[model samples]
Structure formats: structure tokens, C-alpha cells
Target chain A: MAVTTLEPTTGTVPTRRGPDSPRRRKVRRQAWLFMGLAHVLTLKQYLVGAFFAVLELLFLISLPQIVTNLANLVTLGEPALDVPVKERPNSLFMLVDGVITIALILLFVAVYYVSVRSALTQERAWPPDEPTPPRRRLRDTITGAAFPVLGLAPTVVLLIFFVVVPLVFSTLVAFTNYSAPDHIPPAKTIDWVGLDTFVYMFGGSATWTAALARVFTWTIVWALAATVTCYFGGMLIAVLLTENRFRVTPLLRAIFILPYAIPSVVSLLYWQNALNGAFGTVNRTLLALGLIDSPIPWLSDAWLAKFTVVTINLWAGFPYFMLLIIGTMTSISKDVLEAAEVDGASKVSRFRHIVLPLVMYQTAPLMILSFAHNLNNFGAIFFLTGGDPAVADTTTTGAGGTDIMVSWIYKLTITLLKYNQASVLAVMIFVVLAPFAIFQFQRTKSYREGEL
Target chain B: MSDVVVRRINTAAVAIIFTVVAIAVLWPVVHLVSAAFTPGRSMANMPVIPFSNGFTTEHFEYLFTQTDYLRWFGNTLIVATATCLGTLLFASLGAYVFSRFRFTFKRPLLMGMLILQVFPSFVGMVAIYVLLYRIGGLDTLWGLVLFYIAGNMPFMIWLVKSYVDGIPRSLDEAARIDGASNLRTYAQIIVPVARPILTFLAVTSFTAPWMDFILPKLILRSPERQTLALGLFSFVTDKNNFFTTFAAGGLLVAVPFVIFFIATQKSLIASLAGGAVKE
Candidate 1:
């Protein structure tokens, strides 16, 4: 992660000449003046800073003009208070575009600001050669900053345009009255309603509040169940396969991974059918075996549907952990286990004290990530049940028995066009899930190694 | 002698359990294969085991001839291929910069990328839909491709960056001293050494767009432009039947993916299991 090769400036020197020292600080203050600047910087470094400084000026000039134009249209071009929305025409897109452009310009300013600092530091670091012009120091700083600055520009641009812009747009959407009848743009005008939607969602109505509570509570429960079950289920299977006791280890591994290998949509769809209440192969098989009196309503009953989807999720998800844990398990040194054995540890104790901790430590971040993943796992809910057995009571909030927050958001936006409410749910998800992602990412081997 | 006897017994017991679990795991595959060849509308009579109702090529024939399956496959292939290549090109550069360089926002951006990884991009579907609608990208393949590339970038960059981090910096320094530029050193030295992780990212990025249902469902409104996931999904959802046809398509989807996954399963598991993440 070391990018630059430029030598440290005289700022790091311990002598009275150090940049932060009293006399040196006085000199550096004077150095900000045009006359003082010429003393500290070479002509070449001036050109680089001047070039970027001009670009920064351009950004500052252009961005506000766009914002000004949008502001003018919002104010001067507005229809009277009683005028219809169509007569008013929507200023939302123009406003959003202008604001985002300004943000991008500020980002540009920040990037160039750092670049200029390095250029100044470079020119200041060198020992004065007679006339105090060092072309070498100029070249070193330019080289130091050039590749990284230039290399990262494209990705940073992509991040802004795609990730940042969309994020800003979606977040802005949360506060606006952009829902069904009176809010959708172009045909209808949406104004910021502040916290009305959130208030309604949380404290306004008893039914709505209860539904929100129910969906969020179920989402947490589902995440825990999915993670815990898959973790141990995969562990059980992986441990069995790794004993050097199974003759068909390779075949067993392959078969177990099949669920993970198949495209999840395909498997989820098949299971949705296989476990069908009526003629599903699952019910058919069970009936033939005389295990059930009749077909179980696998995908319809409220509580049963949640269990059904979780079971199917386990089927599709376990192989991932199974594979991952088995990898961790096998890589455990035979010598370590034997050493534990020599210490008179039983199999269970050795596993408890040695094996499980080591593997858990390695896979802990992934386990956290997996839980977050299931939290937003849309397909598991969408395809398996489509939030079937919809709780009639929760219609005010548009959730169902099996509806996780993500799926609930999908329902609100796609099925109901309740975009405003959906945006709130989406924001809620990000708020809730971002911390887990941050925590898990900070725990990755790369992050732990301080690579970032 | 007692220990040997005990070990032998353990092996036998584990072997029997493994067989049962293996069969249970493979049950879906067996049933899918059977349904694909079963000459019927729904899987009403097709037995749980293969060949219960005998096999035929009719469902496969129907999937190819009577529907837009081929077109969906073609669209998926194009989207997946473009998404894979685009992800590699962009993600590798981002990863290399992240692995090899320090900049102003390096730490924040790294953490930001991590945060972005879990930010359900599906949340932006409405915004994306409206944006693309204005841009005339709705119902277009490139629109889906653009989103997939952007969606895959953060995770791919993080994964590849971790892999690149494990490589020694001495190689970079040596190359620099040998008169190579920073880009050259990364391109020639770091990338080659990072091939296994790169391959893993490529396979995953390729399959990600292939399996994605939501984005395609939201974007591609027309039947002709539907992806495999969308097309196959519509069979059961939009219709009351076509179980065999759905099975045929699903069976076809699993074949190449399962084989490829099994082949490269080690690299995948290694990278993901903190093996490739280690310094």
C-alpha cells in the first residue's frame, strides 16, 4: 500500500530548521505569499499546481451555475400556489442533477488539493543547491503522485456516477412525497414531506407500526436461524466427510456441493415446486411412503412457509459453509491434533479446545458476512413463497409472513408503487446492514494486516 | 487390536451415513433430470427417481423450438460475458491501485467499498429504472450489463486486492529498480501471480449476472430480451404449467456451472476461506 517514493520533507527534521519550529513556521507562513512561494517552490512545481488550481476554479465556477439554473427554475419558473402540478412542471431531476454535480466538483477539489500538497512538499524537501532550483525533486514528486492519481481516477469516477449518484438519488427519494397517487414525478409533483412517512411508519398507526415490527422481527429471526442452521449443518456434514473414515469422500463432497453449484434461482424454483402442497414431488414421495395423511401446505401456510423457505435456504446455502469449513478443517495440521492427543485430550476436548476455535477464528468474518447476506437475500423470499399467505393484517404496511425487509421493499415498490415507503425501508436496510459489513470487512485478513 | 477394530467400525458407519446424505443431496438433480425427459405437462406423474415414467427428448425439443429459450440463453451469455470481462478490467485496476498505492481517501474508500458491497443495489432499482428510462436504456442488455459491472466492482476489487496484498512488495521494488514503471510491475508481476484469484473473480462475475433475477426482471420488460432466469421463472409463475420445460432449462443451466464449479472449487474455497486473504 506504499504509493509514493518521495523523501520526507525537511518538516521531519529535528533541528531548529524543522518546518514546525518557531522560526521555520514563520518562514512557512511567509511561504504562502507569492513572493515567499517562489523561494520555496521551483518553476516546474508552480506549473503543476497552477494547472490543477485552474481546473479547481473551473469546477467551482461551473457547478454552482448549474445549481443556480435549477434554483431559478424552481423559483422563478414556478406556477402559482393554486396552479396544477402539470402546469408547474417537475424541477426534481434538474435539482438532483445540479446538486450531484456540485458534490462531484467538491470531490475534485479535494483530490487536487492533496496533489498540490505533495508537489509543495517535494519542492520544499531538497537541500538548496546554490541557486535553489532542483529539477530532480520536482520530477520525484510528480512521479510519486502521477500513477496513483491517474490510475484511480476512472474507478473513482465510476463510484461517483454509479454508486454515489444512485445512493444520493435513492436517499433523497426517502423524504419526498413520491408515492402512489399524488407524488410520482412528471405526471405528478412530489415535494419534500420531511419525516411524515417515517412517523407514519413508526408511530402513526397501530397496524402499520405492528407490521413494521413484525417484518423486522422476522427478518432478524430468519437471519439468525439461517446462519445458525447452515453453520452447524455444514459443520456436521464437513466433519463427517473429513474423518478419513468415509470411503466415498470425494463423491460425498461432490454431491454435497451440488446444491451450491446449481444456479440458486433454478434450485429455489425447483424446491418451490418440489415441496408444492398439492402435487409436488416432496408431498408425492411422502404420501407414497405413508408418512403423511395428505399433502402438507409447504408454501402457503404462514408459519409453515417460513420454515419451508428456511429449509430450502439451508439446502442451497449449506454447501458453501460445508465447503469452506471443510477446507479450514483439512488445513488443520495433523501434528497439532496429534500433539493435543499426546497431551491426553479426548476427541471432543481436542475439537473444542483446538479445532473449533481455530476454524471459527478464521471463518468468523465470513460468518458475519453470511448473516448480513441472508438479511438481504431477496430470492429466497421472492421465489419460494412470493410472500404468500400474506398476513391480511399487515396490508397497511405491505408485508407478509415470509417477507424479509428486502422482499417487503420489493413488494412496496414493484407491486404497490409505494416508492416513498420503499425507499425508507431500503435506507433502513443500509443503516442496519452497513455496520455488519464494515465490521466484517475490518476483520478480513487483508484489513487485519493493515493493507488498507 | 481393539483400536483397529473400533476404527474399522467407525469407517463403516460413516460410510453408510455419507451414502444416505449424498443421495439426499443429489435427489434434486435426479428429479430434475427425470422431469426434463418426462413426456408431460406438469411433473404430476414423474416419479421421484429418474426413469420412473421413462425418458424422452420432447421437453428439450419443446424448450428449444416452441419458446424463446435460445434467445434468453443468448442474451444471458452476452450479458454474463460482458459483465465478467468488464468486472475484471475495472476491478483489477481498482484492486491494483488499492493494493499498491496510498492516496488521500484510501482508507475511507476501502471501507466505503466494503459498505457498498452490502448495500443492496436492488434498492436503487426504482431510481435506476427511472434513470434508464430517460436514457432509453430500459429493456436493453447494455443497461443490465452496466449495473452488473458496477454491482460486482466492490466485491471483486476487495477480493482481488486481498490477493494482491499477499504478494511481497519486494517484487515491486525489484521490478522498479530494474527500470520498470509502476504499471509495468503491476501488469507483468503482480497480475500473473494473482491469476488464481483473478480466475475466481472471473468465474463468479460471469455466473452472477447469469443467475440474477431481480435486476433483469425490473429492467428487461420485453419477452424477447428476457434472461434465462427471467424466462424460466415466467414459465412457472406466469403460467400454471410447463414444469417439464422449466426442468429442461434448469437442467441445462446446471450442467456447465456445476462442472466448472467442481473443477475450480479449490481456488474458490481457498480465496473465500481466508486462505488467499492471508498475508
Candidate 2:
């Protein structure tokens, strides 16, 4: 070990040294490098050293197991006829365990780094003017940096083992052949098929390419239409209500909020039941009213099903923006609107020039966020259409006429057991949504001034 | 001015349009509520107008007696309550630490969580299912509760952290001076003062599981372990024609939920719009 010594004490005259003294400067420099042995290791140093050693020992002991898991993750468990059934290695288990092991190892490495850096920080601040006791130093460290570590430990652990591990495992599934009937574990093993799913999805086969193009374009269209329709439709109601002209405004407001107040699953399912083509209430009612030649195939025809989903979505969706816009509009000062009105501006002009701009300025971010929300609105499509009115190609491609990427992902995973394809779609979704996430992140309040 | 004439036309037009839209909006709601009390099991036979089909309680009776509706409701309540409590506890601890402590990678970690929150939780369906199977979380309410708590952490933690940051550090310092430990100060001072925001967090988190169907449907395999969403959905599937019963079960959940939502909507709306406006 590298050693350093302090200057010898003067016999008569005391040394006139500032903070740049050799001993002080050397200690600071060595602390940062996490090097050099002083004359004695304080109790705090011993504790910190012991902590690092324990982590190191744990990592070393687990290193072999980790390697085996990672190897299994790649190979996905080879076939062993000689092995008993109970001892058979399963590919899916290996995959999940491998992911968990990798996550744990990453956590271990991170903690190891943090402990070392913390040790250095403590060492740099060592030996206070009063020569703090080692026990006091350790306690000070605990109350300082270690406080956050202890406080957040449980949350971090839960997030990792539950959230992060599963996400990583699924993302990894995108690159492998982990589908049903062929590569399922215990019966057979999975092998990595990098870029094959991507190629197959994008342009490898005509049917898949057609499905991808159709679903992607529809998803974009649906998101845009849903956002625009809901935003403007809600704005209309909010603007009208803000007129405050009616004595029954409160009652109407209550009536309007019923859609928003009810749980979405219940609403969607109820609408699905109500709109059933043959015996549903809507069709029967229309027939009774003499409003149709015959029963309308509301959810049966592909084009009509798409329209029905969007219109119904408009019904379920508009209330949120109504509440939101009303809140924003109420906050606007009365002066701006009055000023526009006094200038001989018509009601239309006043709305176009003043109220619209203010509301948009305030709620544009939310609109963008809502657009992102609509892209993956699984229940809106799932509960209503159930991606019904399957097109000719739906058998070959998992997508239905009304299926958004998210709902299609659901169908792929649950009904079809097409895990690999589902993961690929999930990755595509991540790629598509990443930009929106970054934009939203930048606009978040805490992000702007998180320094505090 | 000619503008006056136009304004009158516009107001009349707005009134007519509002009336039409209002009728359209109330139509389905009335139909749903009336369907719950309608005499028939078939949805096609039920009249469109409210109470036109004649009121009956057979559906509600069937829901309570013949089906596992109560068990499903209980499971939902247990799972939702556990998720809410767990999210509150962990999120508060995380928020407190983040707000008060100066640690490395805090900013990046927060940013990462913000990004991750955008990805829908169902994207990891396969892995979560397999992971649950390994841990025996399948068909268990606690497994569903565990997933929800973990999923809720990132967003709820950020929300509460922002709220906690507004709280003056002086409160913590004063508690410290009074010989209170850090955890004690957090529990005593920070939490009580942060109650309003915590209430907002509680409402959002609690309401999520009630609306969700896919997660519960995936994790819960047993008839006894089904949630309200799963149970109610089962009533009107392709295989079954229990539309009236489904409506009845749905109404039970909606009535109380709507009341609760309307009551807390003021704070909920503020909390929601607060994020956008903060920019």
C-alpha cells in the first residue's frame, strides 16, 4: 500500500501552514483517488471498507451462477434426453432467471460504486477541527448520504425485481424465437433470431408488411382523430358553458360529467352491449322509431366498426377535456375577453383570437399527452370492437380492422400466445412513444428546476 | 350593428346544438341504468327509452345470488386497497428521500422514471405472466396487488416528490432540533403537511385498478379470484347473453364510484392540470 507521512513537528516555533499543508493536501488528493494508507484507519474507514468488501464477496460468489444464467439465457437450455423430467431445464425459466440475475448484478455494481464514492467523500471530510470520534463520524455519514440509501431501498428493490426485470425480459424476448407450438420450453428450446422479426414485420412477407402498414397508419390516424375530435368538441361545450347563460348550467354540467365520472371499463362494456347489431338496444330502438330500413351493422362492417369506435370514443373521451378546458378557461382573467368584445369583435372572432389562443397555450401540452394516451388506448378498442369484423388477412396477421398496436399486442400475447411477435410490437411501440416521453419529460415542472 | 343579429343567431344555434348533444349524451346513460332494471335478459329486446321495458330486480338478484359477484367485488376491494396503501407508503418514503436528500443520479433516475411511465404496463405482458408463474403470483390477489404497487411507484413518487419539495425544509430542521429522528420527522411533520397531495395520490391510485381489466384478467385465473371488471365482462361475452345482469353489476360499481369521483373531482382535476400548467 502507498503510505504518506505528515511533517515533523517544530520544537519551538509552530509551523505556519494554511489548508495547503502537505498532510491536508495529500489526504484530500488520496481520498478522491480512494488510495493511500494513512497512519491509522479510523473506525468509520473500517466500516466503509467492510461494507465494500461484503459487496465484493457477494458479487464474486455469485459470479459463476450469473455466468451460467447468462449462458442459459443465450442458449435457452439445451435438450438432455438422459436427464430426468424433474431435472429438465426450461428455456422460459432460464430467460426470466437470467434477466433477474442481470438486474441484480447491475444493482450490485451500482451500489458498489456508490459505496466507494461515499467512502471517498467521508475520507475527504475526515478529522474535524475537534477530532470527531469515529463512532460519531459513522453516525454522521448515516444521517447524511446513507439516509437516502436507507429510505429508498425498499422502493428501489421493488421497482427493480418487479418492474425493471419484467420489462427487460420482455424486451429481450423481442430478439428470440419464444413463440408457441415450436420453441416453448420443456418440450423444445428457444434460439436467438436477431433482426428476423423486425425484417419479417417491416417487409419480409407481404401479409405482415400489409398488416404493419395498415395498423400503423390507422393507429396514427386514430390517435390524431381522437385527440382533435375530443379537444375541439370539449372546447365547444366548455365555451358554451362558460357563457353561464342557462339557469340549469350546473345540472347540465353534472349530466355531461356522467361519462367522465363512470369507470371506463364499465362504460366501454356497456356501450358494446348496447351497440350489438342483431338484438342490441340501439338498433331495436332505431327500428321502433322507423329511423332505418333494417338493422344497422354497427359493429359488424369493418368501416362502420372503425367509425363506431371513434364516435363512441368521442363520447367517452370528450368529458375529460371538457373538465380540463373548463378549469383552464375559468382561470383566464375576465379582462382579456371583455377587451376583445369591446373592440367590436364578433363572438366568433373573440373566441378565435382570444379564448382559443389562451386555452391552447395553457393546455397544448396536455393535448399532446392525450394524443400519446390515445395511441395505446387498449380498452377503447378491445372492449367495444374486440377487434372484431376481422378482415381477410387477420388470420395470417393478428391485427383486426379496429385493433390498435396495443390491442393487437394484447391479442398476440394472450389469445395467440405469440410472445415473440408481441414483444416486437411492444418494442416498436416504445420506439414510437420515446419521443413523446422525452417531450413530456422536458415539460414536467420538477425537471425544469429539480436542483432543489 | 349587424353583429347583434349574428350573435343572436349564434346563441340560438348554440342552445339548439347543446340541447341535441345533451340528449345524445344522456341517452346511453339512461339506457344503461334502465337496462339494469329491465325485465329481460336479452339486450336486443330491451327498449331504448328509460323504464319503457318495465322495471324488475331479477338481474340484481341474479348478480348477488347466482354469480360470484360479491367475491369478485371483495377481491377487487382487497387488491385496490392494498395497492393504494402500498403505493402511498413507498411513494411517500421515496418522495421524502428525493426531496430532502442530495444524492447522486437523482436527476437521471427521476428522468428515467418519467420516461418509463409513458410505456403502457401491458407491453410486458408475457414476461409479467411468466414471472408471476415462477413466483406463484398467478391467480392470487397479492400478486396483482404487487404488480400494481410497483407500476404505480414511478408516477406517484414524482407527484408526491413535487408536493414534498414545496414543504419548507425548516419543518424537518425544527423537528431535528427537537430531537426527532429523520424517519420520525418524516412521519410526523412531512406526511401530515403533505396530506392534501397524498389524498390526490390516493384517489388516482385507487381509481386505476377499478378501471383496469387487462391486468386482472391476465393474472387472475380462478373464478373466485376475479375482479369486478373481469366478472362483469364475463356476463356479456360471446358465450353468454347476461346483458341485464352485466348492467346491474356495472351499475353497482358505477353509482358509488361516480359519487366518489364527483366529490373529489376538484382536487383531481387540479392535480391533473397542475402538471401541464406547471410548465
Best by DockQ: 2
Q: What is the interface RMSD of each candidate, in Å?
A: 3.5, 7.4
Clashes of 1: 0
Q: On a 0 to 1 TM-score scale, where does candidate 1 land against the true structure?
A: 0.88
Measured on C-alpha atoms, candidate 1 has an lDDT of 0.76
Q: Write the per-residue lDDT of candidate 1 for residues A1-452, one digit (tens) a residue.
A: 12343312211332334345333343345334322243334434566556555665676578667677557434423424466656665645554564466566667656555554454444445454534445655454444546666666666666666676677677767777778876665665667678888888887867878888889999999998998889888888887877565455777777788999899888888888888888899988888889999889988799999898888888888898888898888778899999989999998898889989988887766777789988988988888887777787756667888999888888888888888788888788878987887685766676776655
TM-score of chain A of 1: 0.83
For model 2, what is the error of residue B268's alpha carbon versus the real structure, in angstroms, after optimal superposition? 4.0
Off by over 4 Å in 2: A1-41, A44-56, A81-86, A128-132, A137-145, A335-350, A450-452, B1-8, B170-180
Query: Largest TM-score belongs to which candidate?
Result: 2
